[model samples]
Target: MDLVITILVLLLVVALSGAVVRILPIRLPLPLLQIATGALLARPFGLHVEFDPGLFFLLFIPPLLFADGWRIPKRELFLLRGPILALAVGLVFFTIVGVGYFVHWLIPTVPLAVAFALAAVLSPTDAVAVTSITGHATIPPRLMHVLSGEALLNDASGLVALQFAVAAELTGHFSLTTAAGDFALTALGGVAAGVFVSAAFGVVRRRLVRWSSEVDPASQVSLLLLMPFAAYLLAEHFGVSGILAAVAAGMTVNFTDVSKGGYVATRVQSVAVWSMVEFTFNGLIFVLLGMQLPGIVGNAKLDLAQAGGGELWYLAAYVAAITLALIVLRFVWVWLSLRFVLMRALHRGEQRPKVGTRLMWTAALAGVRGAITLAGVLSIPLMKAEDVPFPTRDLMIFLATGVILATLLIGAIGLPLSAKKLKLPGEDPRVKEERMARALSAEAALRGIAEEQKRVEETRDEKAIALASRVAARVVGDYQQRLEAAGEEGDVPEKARAEAGTERIMRLAALRAERRELFDLRRSHRINDETLRALIRELDLAEASLTGLHAE
Candidate 1:
């Protein structure tokens, strides 16, 4: 109970600090600010909030990963599968080997297995960093797909590798065959668990909605909030990768229409819940990262002191060397993949290649690691195989922390600059405008139709037509105002707040139209039930465009 109260206070503090992050005029990543706040609270006040590694993994990682997987564009994933797989899987392996070897050389006191473990821990890039840094309008869809896919999948790869490394260190043995078998089983189990959980929940949700029309919106949203953790916990108990399970479950739930309510109700509820969760969770992860500095540095202080200036400089040099290696590895892999694989495939008509040096650079820079690394470092056992001390464990933790900070701080500053320097081709403004305008227009049309039906039921044909004309005119007039306003704002990325407001307006219009159409169809027996669903689905896609926009 005390712990719970402390957490509530921390959450409130973090939430308020989020607003301050924007108001400071000084540009810092919101995560960095949150971390700073956490550190300040910890150091002076002595608030030693030690979160369990298992609890942390179970609580934060699943929903974050699942949400990312659900939102990733399916078409783009199909298109960039080759490069994404290479980076997510192949590059992770390469990083583990490269960094592990270097760490063993630099700190001979640390075993090769321990070094490899450290490398594996640092391998996966953070999804929060990617989402926070990249602009959807500025970055190409292909590149976004590759980056997001790599982040999601490499998380599983990196964790698997870390587990193998840990097991090898503990038992003084490593086998490729065992590793391969474990990976296969974990992946298989996660998918099965996710599918089962999502289906069960969908049925339950449907039944609840059917029985009770006044079900609380918050209660419905809470079910989704719990889903990731539930899926993850179940998978873990069954001896599988919970991360993968949560992601698979989210994807499964998204594709199935097993809910009890109308399509609009489900759609609106989902968008609102996911949107809030994504922002808050993403913001909170960075804050945690920033706050953890004091604890990490304290653990490494003795080692830092023992290592003389000469040794300290060598460590710094090695950190710099490995950091550059990680960065270069990404660029080289991307370039080669494009040149030898993607380009040839395009030529052979196997794929429509998304070609550009700028896109390649975006993929490379987006490789900044965050929560996974922190979680991995914190999870490391204090003792190893012989029950002897884990040599250089603190040093390894410090080194990984350095790599994370460097990548995040540098990438955050460098990304926008790099995008500008490379003269990347952003989205076509005209197409964007047309899409927005049509969306707004469709929304208004739906509202006008609803109002017309209401009047038609109350008045004679002549009076009904007159009232409908006025409503239609008002809807069109509002849409035209928005169109002109959007046209005037040249080349600026639309604010999420404005988009959110617009979405509400459009959704109300769409729902109103569906209700009216359903009423008329019921009275006349003009169409079958399935026909109404098909028509409703057409409007649903327009609503989904809002979901797509939020994902971007």
Candidate 2:
């Protein structure tokens, strides 16, 4: 009961923080606000929230990664694969080497292996942080794609590095050749596992759909929600990288096709379900991050005191130095890579897009660390041997938390200002492509109507011929209107766009009225529930199409 109450209270805080962020004039990011709220609750109010690393990983990480993989633009990810690999794998290893040595030099008490462990903890950028910062900004799509892809893949690499570091520390030995082999095996195995699992699930789902009279959308969505967890657990059971498995599973299962078929309810319900899950899970993670501060700080202080130096300021300075190093290193690496590597690669092709200085800075600043870092740090065991605490565990957590906070602060402040300063264009080519696709679809529908009208005319049924003609006329009119709206004119007058918007609003109002009337008819037994549902589904689809058509 207490646990239940605590959960309810945390959810309430998440909801309230979401509302506050939107309502406030300052336009603070939601993660920053939620973390502050957690800190406040923990400090003055003595609100204690225990950290369970296992449970956290099980509940939050899989779904988050799955959703990212599902929604990521696959084409852009492939196009920017070079940079994504550079950042995700190359930069992560670079940070581990650079920060590992830096930490060892700063704190002689910390061993090199343990230093690498700390570096590994701080290496992977959080997807939540990246998405939240980029979602509202007008950054280029390719940049966003690279960032998203890097975040998704680097989690697995960093965690795998951490696993090796931890094992070396425990065994009092390290082997480079063995580590390399293990990394390859785990990473490759993870990918294979993900592909196998996703394919099996897809086959099963299709079979179920084929055999069943009607598969409930809610049940199908429930199965989908389980997929990430299943993939993760299966890969883990085989001693592979579970994080990568979850990501691969998500990318493998193409929900877009499923959503386009007769599974309208599944599409609609799944969107709402996943959206709610992301909101609640991400909110609680950040808030709980803040709540962990008191315990982390106190532990670090106690450990330092035992080591004969209890200067909290010293630890703060150390965290600050490492945080600064992360930012500076990332900036330099990205700039050099763009200047030397990416430019040369692009020179091979005509009409290649060039990366500018501003874009490099944006990418560098966007490396905000969040939940995954904390999870990695906390998962570090408390002791190495009987009655002996893990070396520098407390300090590592303290520094990891500091890095998370520092990066978030830098990203939240820097991203938008840089975007505005760069005068980045907001136009998306995909929007134009979508409009063209809709116009073509409308044209196809018109052609189908015309063909049907010709067939009806040959039948010599007067009523049917008249109905066919009327439908064909309506289809032609709709097609023309859509094609005109999608035209590449010199400019569309603002007044015309306004009128089109107003017309859409009026059409939506009429659709809603028709739905309400159908509901009333069903209630009055003038129509059966099945008839009402079928009509409502049509209305819902119509409204969705109209809403999507005009949405910016």
Candidate 3:
């Protein structure tokens, strides 16, 4: 417990290190370095960080997965559904079976069940690690969408697969038809649990918001944060997929009526809180990977007598094989699946962008291993129920960790550079033009109001107009500064400022007032629930108008 606290403190420090590293011009693969630092600390000085396996699962995976699923742009995900499904579901099965066969052939001493266990452990792609790379890469939005979407959905599917594989291994009963049935049932359970639980909570929250005007912000935030965990726990307790349940719940709230008027505050708070959780959890997992090493080495009877040359050689070879297979398998799956989907879309006269071979290659290279692999590897049963050894657990953890390191380092360096080389074009100019027009128009309105304020002087009748004018100037000035920054960076053309009009600012101001009221209602418990909810809906539309007005 003491060590755990120490490691957590260290993780916080290292997470800060990661953030600092990001601001540097030099390109360093952050996860690779973090993990390497972990490995070195473990292997040499014996700084170990161990976490409760069940607690680790409960603490980290759900929220991370939920965030990814909820934030994925719905339209893009739906459009690329075919290819994404093929890569996520189809290729996960392929990787598991293909790697299972390869492992069995390479290590004949390992049981077929153990080989399958290894395969399941290796199946899921790490969305967060991939995002961390692509997040910095400035890749084409479409490609990022596809990669992120695939990674997110595939994780849920892969975890379900892992559970089934583990159950099969434990029971010594592996049946294909049963596996398929279980998969369907598990997925349905997750969706059902998420919908039922979140809807109930949403209803409760709505009622509470109506009556609890003085509820502490902390308590409100806590309730929202706990929603995912409660859903996950209940789902898992019922033998469903907890991760999927959390993802579903997050998607439901974020996509549906979760926001009252305090969405901006909610969003701001969520990001700040989740960002910290993500960093600490991620840092600790990687560090724990290192901490677990000594125990793994002790159990494996691995020797550093030859400067660990032989063990390193074997581990590297295995990691290389798995890494190569994951990359190649994705390409094969995506290219074939996309060919079919694109042909279908073309036949239907859908305006689909051409997915060239190059983009497929980029996606293939972007599948870096991270938290999912770590979680699965760490969760491996070291001993069967009979107190007999669960075969190959140590070797498997080492191999999984090796793959994580190799792919993360290589992928981080390569994917971003590869994405840049793809030279995907920028956003459509007409959209940019419309945005600039709105921005300039809003600016002109502010100028007009400022002029009116100066003309009105201190007359009693003009006081409200003068106040209104001042607010307009502040809001428009804020937006104009943003536009000018964009223009300075060559994101928007300088000529866009000249083409806009000024008639929309008063409407925007009116909308802002309503939005402010809605936010207040959201924070207030004494408000009439029905009235607040209805007002929030109107505020959302008004906010959209304000966004357009500023962009002009």
Candidate 4:
């Protein structure tokens, strides 16, 4: 009962946080608001929540990472692959070495391997937290894509590095050659596992759907929801990177052409369900972080006192120093990368894109550490051996959590200031491409409609011919207008576009009226529940057609 209550309460808080965000005068990101709310629950109200670290990681990280992989623009990821790889792989190693040395020097009590472990957890930026902090439109689209791509790949690398670091700490041994082989095996195996599982599932699901006359949207959605977990567990079972597996599964799903026909409800339900899942999981993680904050600090103080060494104030300075070090390191790396690009551009005799100070700072500040950091830090074992607590476990947790909070705050403050009013140079060709696609599709639709009309004429019944002609004219008028509007010729007048807008407005108004009338009928007991649902669905489909038609 207590466990159930805890879950319900957490969910309630998550839901309420959205409302509170609107009501608050000062703008705070929802993640920050959720965390503050959790802290409130923990500090004054004595709310306590705990779980096995392995289970916590298993529950929240895979689905969130999978969602990121699914939704991030694959084109941008591929185009920016060079820079993204630099940040994701190269910068992770850079931070691991630099921050590892800094932490060890600052606090000699922390072993070198343990310092590297701390740095490893901190290196992976939380692009989700950044997105929440700054809306996508606020950041330059290309830079946002790079940040997202980096976040997607680095989580796996950071966590894998942490595992090796932790092993070294335990056994007092380290080997670059063995680690390199293990890393390759782990990453490659994870990708292979994810591709295989997702591909196999896609094949089986496609066959089953084809064999059956009917499809169950609920079952299909359930299977989709299980996909990330399946990939994660399979890779973990094989002693590989579960994080990469989950990511690979999501990216594979995006590439797979499983939504070709007659699966509209399945796709719709999948979108709605996955949206809810992402929000709930993300909210719960931050809220849990908030709840744990008070305990983490108190325990760290005790650990320090018991160790008979460090002062209480040293903790704050440590967090501040680490956070600053990370920011400086990131800034320097980004600056260096830009310079390297400038040199290459000059060498190739190409126009050098103007490098702005604000852009580099925005890129640096956007590196907000989030849930993955929290989970990895928390998962550090409590005991090194029987009757021996892991050295400075609480202290490390305190430091990592503190750094997460610090980075979030810095990003919240700096990103907007740095990124404001900046324009990226390259034009997105998607607009032109979409217009062309619409024109082509409209032409093809016109041909199909004309062919069907001709078939109707062949029926050779006068009344049928008359009805077919009227219907074809009505449908063909819309497509003809659509083709003109979308065509490259650009000869269509502004008035024609304005009229099309008016028609859409009228159609949307009629859809809303139908919805209201159907609901009124239901309320007056004139329509059965089943009939009401059918009517409402029809209205919803019509409304959907009007809205988000051009959305990417």
- Candidate achieving the largest TM-score: 4
lDDT of each: 0.73, 0.81, 0.72, 0.86
C-alpha root-mean-square deviation, candidate 3:
9.3
- 422, model 1: CA deviation in Å? 3.3
Once superposed on the true structure, which residue ranges of model 2 sit more than 4 Å away at CA?
Answer: 134-137, 255-257, 307-310, 342-354, 423-426, 451-460, 490-499, 509-545, 549-552
TM-score of 4: 0.93
Q: Tens digit of lDDT per residue, candidate 3, span 192-257?
A: 888777787777767776787643456556776787788899899999888789878877765444
Local accuracy of candidate 1 as per-residue lDDT tens digits, 1-552: 978876776778667876886688766666667777777877886665666655666667788777877777666677778777888998999889988888777766668998899999889998667666653325554465678888878887887788788888888888889888988999899889988888888887778877895556676778877888888989989999787888788777776553444556556677777877777766565556556667666656656555432444665676677778788877787787767876677678896655677767767887888776766776677676466866667777778877877787877777766655554445654456556775677577667667766767577678767877786677766565444444434443355336546766778687768868786996699987788788766667776655554232
Judge candidate 2 at residue 88 and give its lDDT: 89
Instruction: Give the range where candidate 1 is weakest over 10 consecutive residues by summed lDDT.
Output: 488-497
Ten-residue stretch with the least lDDT total in model 4: 487-496
Off by over 4 Å in 4: 306-311, 425-433, 457-465, 484-493, 549-552
lDDT of 4: 0.86
lDDT of 4 by residue, 483-529 (tens): 77675544473455666788888999999998899989999999999
Question: Candidate 1: misplaced stretches above 4 Å?
Answer: 1-5, 134-137, 213-215, 258-276, 279-292, 301-315, 346-359, 383-391, 424-552
- List the pairs of residues colliding in candidate 2: none
lDDT of 3 at 32: 61
